[model samples]
Target: MIIQMEGISKSFSGNQVLKEVAFSLEKGEIHALMGENGAGKSTMMKILTGIYARDSGTVEVKGKQVVYKGPKDAERDGIAVIHQELNILPELTVAENLYLGNEQTVGKTAWLKTKEMNRKTEETLRDLGLHVKATERAGNLSVGKQQMIEIAKALMTNADVIIMDEPTAALTDREIQTLFKTIRGLQEKGVSFIYISHRMEEIFSLCDRITVLRDGQYVGVKNIPETSFDEIVSMMVGRQLGGRFPELTNEPGDVKLEVKGLTRMGEFKDISFAVKSGEILGISGLMGAGRSEVVETLFGYRKAESGQILINGKEVQISSPIEAIRNGLGLITEDRKTKGLITDFSIRENISLANLKSISTNGWIAKKKESALFENLIKRLRVVCSSPEQQAKSLSGGNQQKVVIAKWLGTSPSILILDEPTRGVDVGAKKEIYTIMKELAEQGVAIIMVSSELPEVIGMSSRVMVMFEGQMKTILDRNELSEEHIMHYATGGDKHVG
Candidate 1:
């Protein structure tokens, strides 16, 4: 065994994240940590890396008890973590980044050996089978390539135990395959890994053993080949998944929105799509492929230089989100923490934000009416909170998303746009969100959803539209859309798509 964690428990403020979570890693093995969002996987890893101090636990790394005060302590102990968010200075070159803090200085800082450092950087990237130029700026690379650089940096530091959190979340099929090959080679060289991710196929295909967590508790540990996905999901969920995506199709009525030649200088160009009442249209693409930009433009957050927006078949000029809202459009932005909710406000306050005018009576605010409305919505949405008075930030990520959705529900817009609605939500909350979307559709609400999860787009969407590098690619009927096909089109590989 390479690492053994016993009775590990961590708490944030008063909230318990990991409760007696126990797991182990073996030498040269890829152990997968499976759980939904906010399930304490990251917290446990942070404890190991000393980013967090565990409330109570005993951790043995390499058969020796370890106490780490910070990431540097963990680094010296041969443990490294590559978070989902890559930490890199954009303006710096690859060589400069590789030797960022520990730079070689001649004569105690008279000058540094740029040529020598660049040569070493070239060797490091080449060792990973990548041709990334040493002098190239870090921000110039794709997300996939940037992830590879992060991995290379970890290796350059001579880490024995590597914990990769969602390393392939944004990578393409080919890039993922390349990553798998690299992982296998590293494994052969005696480096162990703990991979945390949500993709079922990748977990089974890449991991040696799968450790499941549910609601901050360890469910079970099973060998990869012996355990089926159905069994693993059952363990993680603690109940059988009875049709994860509920069947609640509503008839798409008259067109609620029509966009013609929607253009925004260099963001997205000549984009055109119409959404009808009760239809859930999914938009998908690589991270920077203009999926969010197009919808943002439609919502009037970004001005479209050349576009004719027809809501309910009437042309409207919307210069801002307020104007768009007045024209019956609602947009749920991608990032909830920074953009979605008012964390300082109570649940009721956040829920009633979008329709303050409607909730208020005449010139004065109607407190009773607002409370009654939010109470009804709270029960309907199943927002897990102590009460309506609870702060929005006190709720979980999934609940926060539900609150945002509830807030928008008050607007009663003819068309709704959801950007990465289920990005950080757990499986159960995700199911609830799907159910709510279906119910809204049944009630004749038009919804446009942007999701990076291919399964979400394919499963929940009545129709799917793909975007590639600043342009609309192809739109497919639900029956015709597959993960592979959507990916092909979204990445500008029409040859593979058709």
Candidate 2:
């Protein structure tokens, strides 16, 4: 075994998070760690990477029991972990980030070797089958490119073991294929990898072995070729999933939104669509195809050069989100952490922010009414919390998205736009959200869903709209929504009218 963790135990405040967890890995093999949220997967990885001191455990690397104090110690021992939460300096270039630790020499800092670093970074990117410039600012890159950079950082370290948590959560299917190829290449070169994910398809595709952890305990480990998706999911949830999705039978109502000639130069042009009550319309496109920009303009966050928006067949000017909301429009932004919710505010405060006018009397917030609203939404959305006073930042990604949806629900908008509604969420949470969305639509709300996941867009959208190079391609009905057809439209290979 290249690595072995035996009898690992950890806890906080007398609550055990990991109990007697055991795991092992070998060279040239991809080991998968499967678990639910707060099931101690992150905790186990933290202990392995020296982020936390294990309560009682023995870690043997290549048959040698070692002691580590911190991340630097782990790094020196050839262990690297790419955390789920991105940790990149926004202002730093890719080359700078790659060589950040090696910036200074033993004696003094020399004239910062820019050319050598650039050359090495370029070489690394090509090696990983990615085409990112080294001098470009890390913050300017898309989430997929940023993820490639993180992987490059690990490769540059020449670490023996690379631990990745939800690596494909941000990448496209093609990018994920490239990543898997790179992982195989590295594995052949004797670098072992530990992959963690809730997606069983990805696991069966990439991993050699699977380890199931539930409720801080090891359920079992199985070979990929021998295990089935049903087996894995049952082990994780401790039962068979009743149904992947809930029954949604909502009748169509009158059109609540109409957009015509929506154009944003260099982003999207001449985009026209209408969403009716009790309908979920999905918008899909390749990265940089302007799906987000179109939605942003429709929501009044970006200016549309030549467009006419009408709510209920009446022309209206929507210069800002406030105006849009007043005209019965609500938007759940793509980047939830930045644009969806206020991370610093309490759950109640965030949930009630959109309808503050309704909850205020004479410019004074009605505290009691606000409390009732908070409690109501929390219950309605099934937000996992002990009280409404919990900070929004304290919840998980899925719960945060629920809070954002609840916030928009407060205003009672007739049309709701959810951009990447299930982005960065677990499968269980994704199903939960889909149920909520279906329920909302069944209640006569118009929904516009923008998603990059092909399966998700096809599964949830009653109709799918494809965009390529800032132009809307053919709008497809649910029956015509196949992965190949969607990809063709998304890649501008299909006939279209701008």
Candidate 3:
């Protein structure tokens, strides 16, 4: 085995995050670590990467037991990690960022060998199938491209054990395929990986073994060929999930939101849609099909050159997020880390962020009232945390997303827009979110959901609106929605609606 962790245990402020978790990886193997949010998968990886010291147990790398004082120590011992959050310095050029701590120096002068670094970075980028130039500023690249740079940085270490956390979250299909190919190539050279992701298909297709963790305890491990999808899910969630989506029980009512000729120049053009109270209107399309742009415009993040927005049969101008909120509209943005929650703030602060006015009096916050409100929201949303005072960044990705939802829910908006609501969430958490949406819809909240996952859109939406190149291609009823039809319209093919 290249790496083996036995009886690994850890805790934080009386909250046990891991309990006797055992994991192993063979040389050249891609091992999957599966768990719901706060399930200790990330915690275990942090321990192995030397970000946190394990409270108990043993970690052996390459048949030798050694204790790493920090990430530098781990790296020195042939280990590297690509965190879920990008850690590159955006201000630096790609080549400079890649060689950050280990710059090549010229002949005892301590001068940087800039040309040599750039040459090597260019070679690494090309080998990783990235088109980005080594001299390009890291901040200017797209999130997907930046992710590739992170991979390249890890590979530059020549580490035998690489830990990846949700590495494909921001990648397109082509980029994902390229990444898998790269992994396969590296595996042939005896480089092993400990992979973590919420996407089950990726786990099955790319991993050799699966390890399940639940509520900070080790569940079990199975070889990919010997285990079924259902079995792995049951292990992670601690129960059997009956279906992919919750049953929709709400029926459509009067139109709660209406848009006409919404245009934003090159972004989207002449788009129009109506979402009725108690109905889920799903917007589906390719990644760059302007779905997020349209929703952002509606939420007042972008200005629409010419358009009409009608809420409850009355035309209104929402030129800012405050106006949108005052008009009973809420938006859960696509990038949760950047747009949704304030990572450094407490959960209580984030929940009240959207509706501070309601919980305040005469420009002063009502402390008791605020605490009560946040406590209620935290319980209702099932945001698992040590306390409401816990920093938002300390929670798992799923819990962080729930806090975003709770923040918007606190506003009590009549129309709620969720863009890529379950992008990086686990399957169990996805179901919980679906249930929350259903309950909200049942209470007469009009929902407009934008999702790239076809199955989610088909299962939860009352009607699916397909967009292509900033144009509204067609709208399909539930019966007419299919992966093939959605892709056809998304790719500028003929619109077919039943």
Candidate 4:
């Protein structure tokens, strides 16, 4: 085995986050770590990489026990981690970001080999089918491109053992295939990978073995060919989740929000749609198809060159997010870490940030009202946190996403827009989110969900609107929803709308 851990245990402030977990990775094997958020998957990997010291455990590398004081030490031993949260420095160039601390130096002198590094960066990216200029500013690229940069950064390490956390969360289908190909190539060279993702399709297709964790404890390990999806899910969530998506009983009423020829200069053009009360209008499209840009324009995050936004049959002006909220529209942005919540704020503060009017009186905040709101929403969403005072950044990715949803829920908006609502969420939490979405729709909230996952769009949408290259191709009804049909329209199969 290339790596092994026995009886791993860890805790924070007396709260046990991991307990007696065990894992092993064979050389050149693609091992999958499966668990719900806060189930100790990331924690286990952190301990393995010396990001967090285990309270009690034995970690062996190539049959020898080792203790790494920091991630750099672990890197020296051929273990590199690409964390779920990206580590890219946005302000730097692609080449600069790739070689940040590991730059090529001229012997013992401080002179750098810039030309060689850029050329190497270009070659590495090209190998992964990423066609970005090494001199381009990393911040200007799309999230999908940025994620590819992360993968490229990890590959540049030339580590024998690599751990990827949700590596394809932002990647396109083409990019994912390229990544898999790259991974297989590395495996052929005797490199091993510890793959972490909530995507079951990837696990089934790419991984060799699986290790399941539940509630911070080890479940069991199984070979890829020997285990079934149902069994693996049952083990991870500790219960049978009846259906991947809950039944939507909501019937559409009068239109709550409408856009007429919404045109944004270089992004999207002449976008038109209407979402009725108690209905979900799912926006489906490929990367750079302007799905997000359309929504951003509607939410006033981007300016529309020309368009008319009609909220409840009357044209309304939305020049900013504040105005959007004032008009009873709430947007759960795509990038939750940057746009959705303030990581430095506590749960109580973040939740109250959007609904101060309901919890305040005459310019003074009501503590009891705020606390009640926090408690009620936290319990409702099943957010895993020690207390309301816990920093938003401290929660797991899934929990942080739930908190973002809760913050918007507090606004009690008539129209709610969720952009990639469950991107990195596990199966169990996804069901809960679907339930909440259903409940809100039943209560007459119009939901606009933009998703790249076809299953989610097909399962939740009342109507799916496929966009191709900034134009609406077609909108299919629930009875007409299918992955094949959606993909056809998404790729400009038919140019007719409605």
Global local distance difference test of model 2: 0.82
Could you tell me how far off, in angstroms, the CA of residue 264 lies in candidate 4 after the best superposition? 1.8
* lDDT (CA) per prediction: 0.82, 0.82, 0.88, 0.91
Candidate closest to the true structure, highest TM-score = 4
Per-prediction TM-score: 0.83, 0.91, 0.90, 0.96
By summed lDDT, which 10 consecutive residues of candidate 2 come out lowest?
102-111
Q: What is the lDDT of residue 286 in candidate 2?
A: 72
- For model 4, the superposed segments whose C-alpha errors exceed 4 Å read 106-108, 496-498
lDDT-wise, the better of 1 and 4 is 4
For 23-94, candidate 4 gives per-residue lDDT tens digits of: 999999999999999999998998998899999989999899988898998999999888887777889999
State the lDDT at 359 in candidate 3: 91
Clashes found in each candidate (C-alpha, N, C closer than 3 A): 0, 0, 0, 0
| Top candidate, metric lDDT | 4
Ranking by TM-score: 4, 2, 3, 1
Query: Candidate 4 clashing pairs?
Result: none
Q: How well does candidate 2 score on lDDT at residue 84?
A: 66
Model 2 TM-score is 0.91
